[model samples]
Target chain A: MSTTGTAWTPERRARAALTFICEPGRPDLSRFVAEQGAPDVVEALLASSGTAAWSRRARCLDLDALIARAEALGARLVVPGDDEWPAPLAELDRIEPVGGMCGAPLALWVAGRRRLDEILRPGYGALAIVGARACTRYGQALATDLASRLAGQFPVISGGAYGIDIAAHRGALAAGAPTVAVMAGGLDEWYPKGNTRVFEQILDEWAVVSELPPGMRPTRPGFLARNRLIAALSAGVLVVEAAMRSGAVNTAHWAGALGRIVMAVPGPVTSGMSETPHRLIRDHEAELVAGPADVRALLCAPGEQLEGPWMTPTRPLDGLDPRLLAVREALPGRGSLTVDQLASRARCTSAACDGALVELELLGLVEQDESGRWRLRRPR
Target chain B: MSTTGTAWTPERRARAALTFICEPGRPDLSRFVAEQGAPDVVEALLASSGTAAWSRRARCLDLDALIARAEALGARLVVPGDDEWPAPLAELDRIEPVGGMCGAPLALWVAGRRRLDEILRPGYGALAIVGARACTRYGQALATDLASRLAGQFPVISGGAYGIDIAAHRGALAAGAPTVAVMAGGLDEWYPKGNTRVFEQILDEWAVVSELPPGMRPTRPGFLARNRLIAALSAGVLVVEAAMRSGAVNTAHWAGALGRIVMAVPGPVTSGMSETPHRLIRDHEAELVAGPADVRALLCAPGEQLEGPWMTPTRPLDGLDPRLLAVREALPGRGSLTVDQLASRARCTSAACDGALVELELLGLVEQDESGRWRLRRPR
Candidate 1:
């Protein structure tokens, strides 16, 4: 039985066989498939002598047996033309290989009750929340909160690793929102073993996606290849906490290369985990995101404002009365000035200045020091 | 007795009277001083009718008495032409007024053991480290460490307030380096009585300077006016920690307006004190600085690097061995790949890949996962 349509076409079955034969992100194979089509490329590889890596790898593959194993594990092979395939993955075809890895997967072994296209639709995109597996408590908390807040508006996508990733998925699940786990291994095996429960929960409600066929163990290259998928699939990638050299930073680089927004949450400079975020922000590689509102503001369309429940209404200073606005402007951006000093600068009488200060104080627009000086209140 | 030269000139005496009569940074008086010269402007103001603010204020001044009082308080008057006057203050004369305050002080009433000119010279320019008076313990510690680290190369300049300022001065003093306190009020009366001991220590070892004459109290405007002096006196301004509306941010603005390097140390975002630093860094108004090395790197002329004591030598990745570099380039920026996976990507035999991995691991260029996969080590 075909999972994508009424029946699997020759091209679709060939693409499925190619996934088992060639490793994910083989640029040579992808170029061949793009130029000659999957069925032609598969036939050429299978019939060739042991001259190329693909031919040697394909010689041992039992295509029918591999397809049967995927079906038995309740996985569906979704190729590029499938209705369940995410459209954003097509962007990967244009990216030059990074670390000898490039191009869209030949076929995705997807296991979930939900459809991938519906979860990652046009307006409702996915946000990849990723960070160090050994992240600090602060990093974990920020990742969780950010994911939970954005989950309703967008699917929270992440690798199913410990620390930040687990926290993000759990946060989305706790909010009863769909979250996707883009794994480095096959759909049948949970790589970390420690996160088996989280993987099970994601499988129950969301999707666990892989490029490899059933029972194939995760390789280091597979994880790096997997990062590109996470970057391509999401509208933006938010690095909550990472060391100076981390996989999260790698993901951010991929996001940037793909022209996606790369944002990072800042932490104390003293923590080793905060180094990547600080460096990214300092080098202008990533924008600094304080909370969910900042993330929403960056990702959403200009006129489409989505205020999270946790965000406070930001009252614009321009809405204040002209006199009050003048008074506020006269106050030093830092430090205090007395009413008389403020009056002279604000071009008003002492009485008028005093009245404005009182009104401003009542509105929490200004504050008075112990020495009876006035200054603008800092907006939260 | 004169501190700067053989004897104080009549022009110097005129400037001293101007400081007592006109408030610091009055653009009208500053313009008058700039156009007519300090002595001529002082004469004109004292002789004129009560129309303009400067003339009205000047009419009541006892110029001789004010000079006598300053001398009696062991304070020497330093005019623009005096050797003791810091050259950087000239930038103030060119700055367009901010909040009705601008221009160089007519004269500074200085009281200290160390000479002002010697402490704030061209090659050994001062660094202004300012922050919140109500700062956190973390802020205080950072202020102290940064001050102490830079003290050997640069004199520390700050307002002698209760929190960050006092800590900065104490840190510099502990390092046995000269520190300058640019106070708002006269040197005779320490503004904040609580910081009297620190002020005494500073006066005994360094310098306590003010635009206001002896016995005059600090007005709210005087403090605001003093901030510009702090900004103008330094080569750069490093905001350690500040609230949203802090004097440190005001100082940073002045530094920016005067084309000085403005730097800020990042702290935990959860703290209210970090708001100003984060805002400055986030807005690109200030460069992010974690320690003295960053400060040195920014302030030093291009190719005139001064390595800080705490800085570590950074090795360039391009300097690695050829085969090792090839293996490194083959590794994904994030995640791992097994020996076989790596060999295929590196275009080398499995045995060659294993040898390179061992060499790379020894060099701390790469690390192995629990599954014996290899990945590049993130550089600090």
Candidate 2:
């Protein structure tokens, strides 16, 4: 097999066959593949000389049929040394194992429009947005808003579940940005038939990826194994809302164990859906985030200038009403002004100016003094 | 002037007279009283040798009439050296000044049935519950629950206003515990007449206190000054809910400045009332508390056993349903059991056992395994 170009090598076929034989996040198989190369490990497994578990599983595998099935589904296999493979997945080998799960996939089956390397670049990384499948309206709204605002700068990644995940993907797509959906099942069949519309939309513009080959079904272990890939692929993870012992909390734990920044949006303490987020924030395991700015502040470098949502300076002043703009401009450069004095300078009635001052204060443009005088707050 | 006995000494009369003369939390007068004693400071103010502001206000003071008015209003003055004076007030002299306000009150004009010293003992301390005057129903409910649970072991102190304060005092009174209402105005006249019913109930069983003498109205500065007394008098402060710029945030700042444990309850992000609590928790100014247990966990010292509310071990298991108890008892000692296995062991249907497991999981009595099995969580 050639080292470069579009031709398929023997080693590539062996890696593709291994994805169907062993489950994802198998540390022993991953380590074996790393040390002995894919073709050698595949030959050893075919010999049936490995452990009882591996030998028993290998006896039923057919390598050529799996490769043909992947091709029939229009899925391309990307191995570790492929040009389109993400480099951050290598960090999985260093993290402590969780729930008898560890290590990166030896091969990934990609079946979508966008290239993985182009979307998940080296300097600019993707953000994983995960939450409860049975979410409240508040959680859905916040997830949509955060995803829409962040999509322009970063690729929104999620597990493509029903509530929060579909909302996030729809938000990013609404903003005309590409979003990747990592599926637990094969690309041929979406695990949740209810989310077929969102899955189709994601395949049109971005990618739907999985470690399992075509014709394989999603299992309990498959979903848990997929969470590590979501955490390892993203620069940071933002949990919109989750229950006490849900899958989202499991993903957050993986994010933390991988040394990635973990953030959670706070919700009403009265809701059962907010329990995990509240526990994460209350126990100091995750930073509290309200919007895209808070997410960027935690994910980006200190001096990196964020560009979307409220970060743009021109938008805040331009969005103000005429009366509010007049009131903001009427304040003195150094001293403060009372209601009557501001009314005279702004060329409006005192009541109108007072109402405008309250709006301005909410926008953080002005502040009230102890003597009930109004002054322009210094620019941050 | 006699130094002892039940008879009112001349110095005691001078301290009583000072309560009517100076405003509460007046650093200048507090320092003067501390250095020169109450009688000497009263003499200097009467001779018009003090600052222009004090001399101008002192000229209108009639000490005898003021004392008679307090007596008619059923109020008595308690000074620093009195046995009924709260010792925590002495910490006021050491806290950093806020809003140009500092120092303990020269004397407290108290009216009601309970003794301040006995209610606010040296070992046990009071918890100040303060929030917005215009609060939501959610805030009121949480305030009531926390106060009712905490009132058994600690005195619930608050600024007896219309919303959260009144709710807290009413909760404590409903639990038959002595509560203290620290008023911004004189104890004789409650500031918000809407809360007269609650104020009356508090007076029948607890104490209403203020630094200003009877017949004095509450001013903006007077309200700000009274916040210091609320902070200094409490062992800890719990902010139920507040707007962006409210007095509750100011009280929390004072609590932090006074080295008191500052805590806030989180609410829905959609509501503007949760802004201050969210900001406090986000900025690390206050610990986030959900209910009374979270509050006690922060306020109680290490190894100090908390006795009220959910802290009592006898309450939890006794409150569980029979089905949940049977399911909990069916779990194995070492390994986890599937729902079907638990159902067979507990002699119940699978669906019933499933429901019981969910309820037990919520109560934190049981945990689910990765393979969909149930196990008892180790006791906290």
Candidate 3:
């Protein structure tokens, strides 16, 4: 299984083993591995290390069994040199540490039909939508609607949790677009167990990835470390709803550290679930996004006009010349106005008003009756 | 009556008559009045001008009747040099015009018990809360609550309209604070008679102001002109809810142009009323505020610390050393750990972990069991 031609190499084997030994995003270990190469670092650690946590985890060797378990689950190990490895994840090593966590994953256990790198490539980026597990219905509906509208263009990414995360993934699925889940623990078992159905559907159409090897349960530090991956793997992160102390805010922190576009959806200030998002927006840590069009305006490539109608819905009288617009607004809602009366109300000279009236007439926005009094063509 | 103390001077009478002649916010007339004193400009228009709107209205002047009606309504005219005139209104002359309307009012008809200058003086500011007349319950509740909370510190200002305006004024009155209503028309009769009760209460306890004199009705242009006064009188303007084309957005624009702090309260994205607030926040035209505390932070004098408990609620272990925080987070919720075990999970050296545990013990955050394992002092 560790042979050539689609099989794991020595470097891949060492990286896979490292995931089981050292915790994800350990700066010291990652730096050491980067300097000395993974296989050499693994060799040195396994040879002379005593009671150190990495050595202890390494002494009990079950590399073959771990690989077999992953294979049984139809999961594959993707290391740094793999063609399917995401390019954006490389940014994690360059960004400053966040919450005592940093560094890209040594290896990822990927379980899915879709290619991880394709959907997340530059110019065609991914959006991560995250929020509270006990979000309000407003949050849930907004998350779903925003994801559904944007996922067709930008693949949605999120943790496969109960509330906002699952809603985002479901929204993407509803749009017939593949979504990605970056998990904190092993790919063999879904963490919550309640989301097994959604997890299964994701595996059928998209991808679920973890930095931890098979048989490892999630830890508090693991979730924080996993957030860095979520931030690094996407072009932008949109926080829908979150409490002050939540994984979603931590994810936004990571996204900010990685220089990813951080956006937040505004909800009722009365809702506790919206506290973090509102705080982020108020503090200038995140851009306030109202809907999918706003999300696209920030995430889409420059010169790309992908915004939806909600961005700036044109009223019937939009785009009119200022003089014409003023003349139209000056016209009475229920009664007709003579040219002089309209000119005075609009603060325009008679010549300017006459010019505006002719243009307004050409646009079919206003009409003059036989008595020469002007009113709206379609009065409200 | 026109010659004694608190009586109208030639300049004051000229300004009073001009209010009934030219429309409010007419740049040309306001500039003419500013360049040539009001008394001289009024004489010129009333003497020789013909067929021009100002001259036409000037020729039909019933100055005594207008003055008598204002006196009957208990409304007094305040002009530029008056002691009670707001200094902020002077900025209107320098700002670029909006909607073809600009310039300070020739005179303001103020009806209230409270002195406008005292409440709106520098270092002690007023807040303008405006929104759509057809607002949601969420908007209504937020407007009322925000106004109530902020009005005590800063007098609330708003339009005397049906929905958010009336709600905001009522909130201020409920808090036993004065609120000012900047109306589009005469202060003699409330535009929306449905709000007559609230308007009467305001006139009794606070103020109802307008650039238009008594007997003048509000027109489409008059409302646009009125929004400028709401912006000019406040230190900050907070848009609670508004459609894209509503007066609240226009007030926010005036606030920006006047170099005043512009703020907006966020609500549900599904609401049309929240659209303008969200758009303003998204475009960086306004800051997103959750409630009163945020409004105060932006509006309060420099170096003032008026933030509330909701600003940043401190948790029990918030100020702990990073090593101790990391160690605390690493400990399992249901179990205890040895120093070495904790160090490994916390990604800290064993010596560092031992130091952190000692400090954690001193803070009563963690303790050692009989078997010498560390656990939380108040375990969840």
Which regions of candidate 3 deviate over 4 angstroms?
A1-5, A305-380, B1-5, B305-380
Best prediction by lDDT: 3
Residue A41, candidate 1: alpha-carbon lDDT? 82
Q: Model 1: residues >4 Å from true position, as ranges?
A: A1-6, A51-53, A306-380, B49-56, B123-125, B307-380
Tell me the tens digit of each residue's lDDT in model 3 across A287-363: 99988768877986654644222122234563345667899999988779999999999998988998999988987
State the lDDT of candidate 1 residue by residue for A1-380, as single tens digits.
22443356788788877877788877655656867999888888889986788898788788888878888777888877678888788887887677677787777888877778767766676899999999988988888888876887778899999999989999888887778999998887787999999988987887888888887888988889889889988999999999988999778888987888998888787789989888888778988777776787788876464432222234445235677888988999899999999999999999999999999898888999889898878877
CA lDDT for candidate 3: 0.84
List, for all models, the DockQ compared with the true complex: 0.34, 0.45, 0.65
Per-residue CA lDDT of model 2 for B302-336, tens digit only, reads 64554433122334664356778889999987799
Candidate 2 on A81-193: residue-level lDDT in tens? 78899888888888789888889889888877777876776656688999999999999998888887787667889999988888899888887776889989898879798
lDDT of each: 0.82, 0.82, 0.84
Q: Which scores higher on lDDT, 2 or 3?
A: 3
Write one digit per residue (lDDT tens) for candidate 3, span B1-380: 11113687788888899999988887666667878998888788888757888888988999889988988888899888778889888888889998888998888999887668755655567889999899899888888988877776678999989889989999888877768999898877679988989988987787788999999999989999999999999889999999988888889988998998999999888888889999999999999999876887898665464322112222555334566789989988877999999999999999999999998888788999999999988946
Q: Is the docking of candidate 2 incorrect, acceptable, medium or high quality?
A: acceptable
